[model samples]
Target: MLTDVRKTDRLNLMDQRGLRTSTWNVLTPNAPASKNLLSEELRKNKVSITGLTETRLTGCGEERIGNSDSLLWSGGSTRRNGVDLALNSLARKALLLHEAVSDRLMKARFGHKHGKMTVIVCYAPTSNSGDVTKEDFYSALSRCLATVLPP
Candidate 1:
């Protein structure tokens, strides 16, 4: 029942009567975000699941971001890295695997009861990085498309 979720790091859940449903607040970096913050929010909100984007994480590491109760799964960070989700049962059966295609590129795949899928997280060149042309973009897109397209 997430009524409003925003980038500043606060989440709210509300019932129809204007009564409070729940509140989620957590801090990132500069200090560890307290686990209790997430736990309390999850409990109040009755949150089963969700995802985070633009996490902006730069590297990979195994550290819990939010509290154990509030979050079931997490990914990404303060760079371009991010995460996906599955809840209690989903956590039990989840497997995250990384394949390095290059230093600037990699793919992370998740395998579950439903099937297997991948997220190709890459550090693609931006428009003004250098002298790369539209032709380069097309070529890169073509290579990336190989995962979903026919031979």
Candidate 2:
């Protein structure tokens, strides 16, 4: 049910037998030129939805050119550090979302539309330069998201 694909080929076979929609997650760029690379890929694959994490989004203005997706976010109460869930402009749903910046959970949800569901993407901080610290952060993140996950 889970697979990690190599970035070279740019080909992915989807299992849409029972699934009506798909959400592909990627480490987004803060650059404008990168849009061409993904725009082509998206058009080719017919990817319906997306859940991008680690997207160095410095602005919340949502003035992108290539894709005019209405991005929704639960901003980190502080300043520039936060997460945004950019829905492909076509997705029609009243998004149910929340972000806990001081804590480990950062989530976004889009429920029920064209028989589709949402995937919560979290940006948990890496505790420190050491592995032990990173491990601790991962554990805490797991526990945090666990509370909001569907049972």
Candidate 3:
């Protein structure tokens, strides 16, 4: 079983191997304090790229979190179903494209010397949501993926 300690160790191993990526469901990232806390956690974990779900942030844009971290988020006016991608300095420097597909989905592309990496952050509808809503969310996600052609 992968306990918390094992998870941390595994992540550290991945970092040592130069594979620094992570994901989190932050639930709400609209506040500066929350963003700061998340940034600190990412730095502590030595994660270069992170996908965040349910950010609850409105509008769509790119914002610098700290001196070396950046966030790309997408959300609607209702303060719900937002997604984001956070990138450390190294990943930010390699950032080639970012798209706010919808309140439920966001995409980011980073160009490395070896090739390109595409990351998608998504929030699917909860079970409480209606069937139509769930279907729409999946359909939107599909469209977003379809549009992101390979480099």
Candidate 4:
């Protein structure tokens, strides 16, 4: 396993034990080529979980990428923005629940030996977008967080 999974400064506060998680902006995951590439990268890095943005896949559901990996994803009707969580076999086994909040946000919960961990993956609108759009996104995010009860 990789020792340092938090390549981004924002993720430095996360626990860094044996759990390996990554986040990537995957441009367009609706394409088969992109999905294959993502799966390859996850295997190469031995990542336990990977959060993806801009998947461009419609609707929300779970898909088995291969024998050892699974994907939970959510997208809007227009296929514009999306978020997903890819879990390796080990991580999949520990999964307790997963929610597809909206096109821009998704969440997954895992139960480990010690406790439960919740991962929220999201994508925000660019500054070029209207202020109303940004506000709506944040409002949806707040609702999603409010639904999560403490362990």
Using lDDT as the measure, which candidate wins? 4
1-151, model 2: which lDDT tens digit per residue? 1111122221122235222243434445456665555545544555444444555554343334255444443333334334544444344233444343322234544444242233555565555448875676588667656655552
lDDT comparing candidate 2 with the true structure: 0.44
Better of 1 and 2 by lDDT: 2
Q: How many clashes in candidate 1?
A: 11
What residue pairs clash in candidate 3, if any at all?
none
lDDT on C-alpha atoms for all candidate structures: 0.36, 0.44, 0.76, 0.79
After superposition, candidate 3 runs with Cα above 4 Å error = 1-17
**Models sorted by TM-score, best on top:** 4, 3, 2, 1
TM-score of each: 0.36, 0.49, 0.84, 0.84
RMSD of each: 12.0, 10.3, 9.2, 8.2
Off by over 4 Å in 4: 1-17
Off by over 4 Å in 1: 1-60, 69-93, 100-104, 132-151
- Report the poorest 10 consecutive residues by lDDT, candidate 1: 1-10
Comparing 1 and 2 on TM-score, the stronger one: 2
**Candidate structures ordered by lDDT, highest first:** 4, 3, 2, 1
Superposed by TM-score, candidate 4 places the C-alpha of residue 70 at a distance from the truth, in angstroms, of 0.6
